[model samples]
Target: MAWLVSTPSRKDDTGDRLFLEVAAEAARNERIRAIYLDVRAQAFANISRAFAGLMGSDAVSDEHRALAQAFMLIELGSVCARTLLNEPVQPASDRLIECLVGMPV
Candidate 1:
């Protein structure tokens, strides 16, 4: 959250946006879509693993994975809110992170 808040907002050139553009021109089963899907999946798995590690998950179990997923959704929503409002979401986000991370793992 700190990193997210500190970074200046530019148009985030995320894979989801890129995938949308490519998807417009490509069939669902096309290799390009498959590649993007894999990339997106791997990216998410990687993030979940990272969070699990941070939260001291030895095996990245389902509970840990769900916790990580929740974090991702919150992170994405906070980013979207910040972007749309063109404002800083620091103390609120910081507090939220504290409440989340401080939870029993």
Candidate 2:
């Protein structure tokens, strides 16, 4: 999956705006919050699929599910930190990717 390595160049993060918008809406709007929760579950499923693809497995393994959940949390944190600081996700995101490679999933 492209998302596995889809970190944008720092200056070209066009997705950040929409991410912030969704984050704000989820914080205050109950309907959007529910939808966002569903979206997050879907994201986790998507990530599991991606990880399975990487492993050349047709089904997502337990290890894949664990790694996907961890990676999702890291990604969400990276986005939040970037939006709050008005900066690019950097070394932290890079570091997370590195961890993924070494992880046994």
Candidate 3:
């Protein structure tokens, strides 16, 4: 992964460089994988809640509904990627849950 990102053409791209660095670092640490798993779980939960809310709102237009569905699909991809990494499932932060659900923290 890092090798792909470190290609000559992409070597100067800060985002690619950062991604390579992070991937290398994560590869060396089990804790980073666990942290990523938690974050991805929270993201998936938030996206699911947002999708449900959008689907239930009568005020939302068909176009917006489609967009929301697309967003949910993207989040699902993230969830799948995290699952593939085989990170242990852990409880998500309360702050993340509250922010995602729009509930008082």
Candidate 4:
């Protein structure tokens, strides 16, 4: 769920942030929670795989490897949050992508 993270901000009729409003709505819905849980589980599995791959690589420096793992966790949280709101999955920002791929390793 990258769309929500990338979406422009707006104010709701109640003058509250639209993103917060949507998040609150999702929080109240059981179906949305279920979907979020499922997605979160999958995200964690993916992160585990990536971490394992990184651990096996001798080329990656410890600091950069740790950063990469942290980045995966951050991305997982972001995706799960967006999934809770049923947002479309969009590509992550180019800068973030670059950091994930180009970080000294």
lDDT of each: 0.59, 0.75, 0.43, 0.48
lDDT of 3 by residue, 1-105 (tens): 222112212213355445445656777888986776676567555544554553465354444444444544433333433344533222322223323334221
Off by over 4 Å in 2: 8-14
lDDT tens digits by residue: candidate 4, 8-82: 222122433343455466699988767666765575555445544554653435554465456655454444545
lDDT of 2 by residue, 41-82 (tens): 898899888788787789998988987887777777777777
Candidate 4 local distance difference test against the native: 0.48
Give the clashing residue pairs of candidate 3, or none.
none
What is candidate 1's TM-score against the reference?
Answer: 0.57
Task: Give the 10-residue window scoring lowest on summed lDDT in candidate 2.
Answer: 5-14
Q: Which stretches of candidate 3 lie over 4 Å from their true place?
A: 1-24, 57-105
lDDT for 34 (candidate 4): 77
lDDT of 1: 0.59
Q: Residue 34, candidate 4: how far off, in angstroms?
A: 0.6
Looking at candidate 3, the ten consecutive residues that score lowest on lDDT are 2-11
* Global local distance difference test of model 2: 0.75
**Candidate 4: clashing pairs of residues:** none
Residue-level lDDT tens digits of model 1 in 6-104: 332323547435534665545655877787667757866876676577677767767656656666565655556555565665666666656656667
RMSD of each: 4.7, 2.5, 14.9, 9.4
Instruction: Give the number of the best model, judged by lDDT.
Output: 2
lDDT of 2 at 33: 96
Comparing 1 and 4 on TM-score, the stronger one: 1
Superposed Cα deviation of residue 28, candidate 3 (Å)? 4.6
Question: What is the number of backbone collisions in each predicted candidate, taken in the order shown?
Answer: 0, 0, 0, 0
